[model samples]
Target: MQEAAGAAGEISEFAGPSEEEELQRQARAVAQPDETEALNWTMKKFRFPLERLLNYRRSRLAGEQARLEKLLAEQAGLEQRRAALEREERMVNESLRRLPVISSEQLAAIASFRRFAASEAVRLAAEIHAAAGRVAAQRDAVLSARREVEVLEKLRERRLHDWRREVDQETERQTAELVVARWALSRESG
Candidate 1:
């Protein structure tokens, strides 16, 4: 339960400031008209505070994907090697069947080759199994890393959206103020 709470806390921290916090900040700004006047109603650039963390997560995800690619390559190589071994074994068997008057020495040599091929086949099978296992584990690791990156990306997108909304509201407020000032000026001068 403690671990779950800790995880939740971590996720919330990544989620950026709460709406209440944003409202409090806006209230403070409204209470201080001097600060707003000094800025001339220019919108500040949107900057995500956790940009570095997001970059780090993206790099980690890239590394995990690279590892997965390497594991897959290794698995493919093992499979190709096993296929080559099977082809050689089939060729040897075909040659033996064609030999009608084979001498004892030839028979012994053929048997030795067959035994070696069988042992090698077993070894290759074991290697292929191990390689497949490694590939599967690496795939899982890549998936985990991808998920982390996606979470951060989603948070970043959400924050950007909020910033845009705030900018729009500020723009509307400034427009209304300007329209009111223009109307008052026309009424007095006319």
Candidate 2:
């Protein structure tokens, strides 16, 4: 009976690893991080280098647009004034036609007023033409500024995409490492 009891104790002792020992081994493996994690450390944060330039370009575009609007407003005011002058001139002509007994002095005065109105109309038309040219030039400036900003933004987007791809690769690599580590552990225990 004593020899059988001793043999049973020897068999229990030779039983591979206890449940508690297996749990402890797993804990130790978790504590000892793999070399891959130590090497990778952390990823670089994304940053746009031309952010300030982009902002400046947007602001320049806004300024150019504002100048165009101001020019348009000035041209509109000039047109309105010209329309008022035309209406006044028409009223004057109507009055002259309705007058049946106008003196020579009155006729000369009306002729002088008509000459002044004609000169003023010519000056205003020239100013409107100049304003139109300025507005067209400002529109071109705005378009150029917008294009510059768009180029910078596209570059930024491409850089961001590359950074994301790198991050995803790193994540996949770390996941692969973890899987490999788990597989090694399973082999060792099995």
Candidate 3:
């Protein structure tokens, strides 16, 4: 267990979000207004290097989500238009089927109207298809942004835990050394 702990400490040093890095991160936070406010108000006692990255990632994720929502809204509009066009086409086709033996000019006018409705329906269907594709792509982008933020957050948590462990281990080591030295001094005096 002791060997494992020592090895873990050594690994943490190499994998470092080291104490100096944490201090530098806090120092840099002085330049950011948001960070300064959070520093002043929050319960957090220290800053980590990943804090800046996390903030940037969070903003990026928000932007991605907003983009996705906009694309979805546009897609919904296209879908509504397509449905309306299809309904109009059906109504026109039904009217043409019922109006038997009308004047040649009247029949030609109804046929022209039906053709226009079909053309519009085709155009809207194409637009809806393209908009659906864009929405899918935007959704993927949102998911990617979320994944990036989540990874950074998890990394920050791990680094914080390692830092705390390092601090506790150092405190324990110092206390043990002090106790051993005191024991030696008392034994020699005795």
Tell me, by TM-score, which candidate is best.
1
Error of 3 at 25 (Å): 39
Per-residue lDDT of model 2, residues 77-99, tens digit only: 99999999999999999998999
Distance from true location, Cα of 144 in model 1, Å: 0.4
Residue pairs with backbone overlap in model 2: none
Estimated TM-score for each candidate: 0.77, 0.73, 0.60
Ranking by TM-score: 1, 2, 3
Worst 10 residues of 3 by lDDT: 24-33
**Candidate 1, residues 1-190: lDDT per residue as tens digits?**
9999999999999998898667555544444446657577778999999999999999999999988898889889888988998898889888888988889998899889889888988998999899888888888988898999899999999999999999999889877765665565555447
Task: Please give the distance, in angstroms, between residue 102's alpha carbon in candidate 1 and its true position after superposition.
Answer: 1.5
Residues 74-143, candidate 3, lDDT per residue (tens digit)? 8898888878877877787777678866788987887797788778878878888898898899889889
Superpose all Cα atoms of candidate 3 onto the true structure and report the RMSD in Å to 1 decimal: 18.4
Ranking by lDDT: 2, 1, 3
Q: Count the backbone clashes (under 3 Å) in each candidate.
A: 0, 0, 0
